[model samples]
Target: MLVINALLRGGIPFIIMGGIALLLNYQEKYSDAKSTFFASLIVFFVGAATVIYNIDHWSLTKQSVVHFLIMLITVYPILLLSGWFTIASVFDALKVFLVFVLVGVILWIVMFILAKVFSW
Candidate 1:
């Protein structure tokens, strides 16, 4: 579903932002839930707009990669800001890496199902 895809693309960064806020005890400084929801909405609109704009101009493969990359680029900063890669232990980074992989897998599965259903 569109909602699922949007969540898949934006959920990690949103979570990271929330985690960082919690870790820094800065929950009051930022409206984490509102900001995350808005970010996800932006991502979803960007994706839908991209698809609509490219409907007659791009292949599915190209669109998929572009969309994925766009989502990744949009979220990478949150990962860094969340201290996801600067943990004191290797296991911590690995845990984050696993979560990233899991997210990717879920995104792929959803996209695959969508593709099949839409015959893309």
Candidate 2:
């Protein structure tokens, strides 16, 4: 179950990133699927490590929108580090940022609905 959550949390974002990258490729190709996938894997590792390094401090006993949003935002820069860390301009970065944000919104909705249905 833990492993699945880890995968979904990262995998869903990767799908979002890849899909957005494909769509946003209209303007000079900000990033590619390969880079997006690689970056998302890095994000998974980084996020997991952050929690595992101090498990007691970060248990998910309670879910809060603020914490979830902050974590989602944290992932954006990590994705940028892997995908657009070089000569990408702010506009290009913003494009990726917006993509993740849209995905984040969708993810939040899914999570909320799941919680409601499952009484989590």
- Among all candidates shown, the one with the greatest lDDT: 2
Q: What is the C-alpha RMSD of each candidate to the true structure, in Å?
A: 8.1, 8.2
Model 1 Cα displacement at 72 (Å)? 2.5
Clashes of 1: 0
Q: Global lDDT of each model?
A: 0.56, 0.60
lDDT of 2 at 15: 67
In candidate 2, what are the lDDT values of residues 1-120, reduced to their tens digit? 555665666666766666766666655556565565556565664444333322445545333444455565667667677645442689878787777778766866786688689974
- In terms of TM-score, the best-performing candidate is 2
State the lDDT at 67 in candidate 1. 64
- Cα TM-score of candidate 1: 0.44
Q: Please report how far candidate 2 places residue 83 from its true position, in Å.
A: 2.6
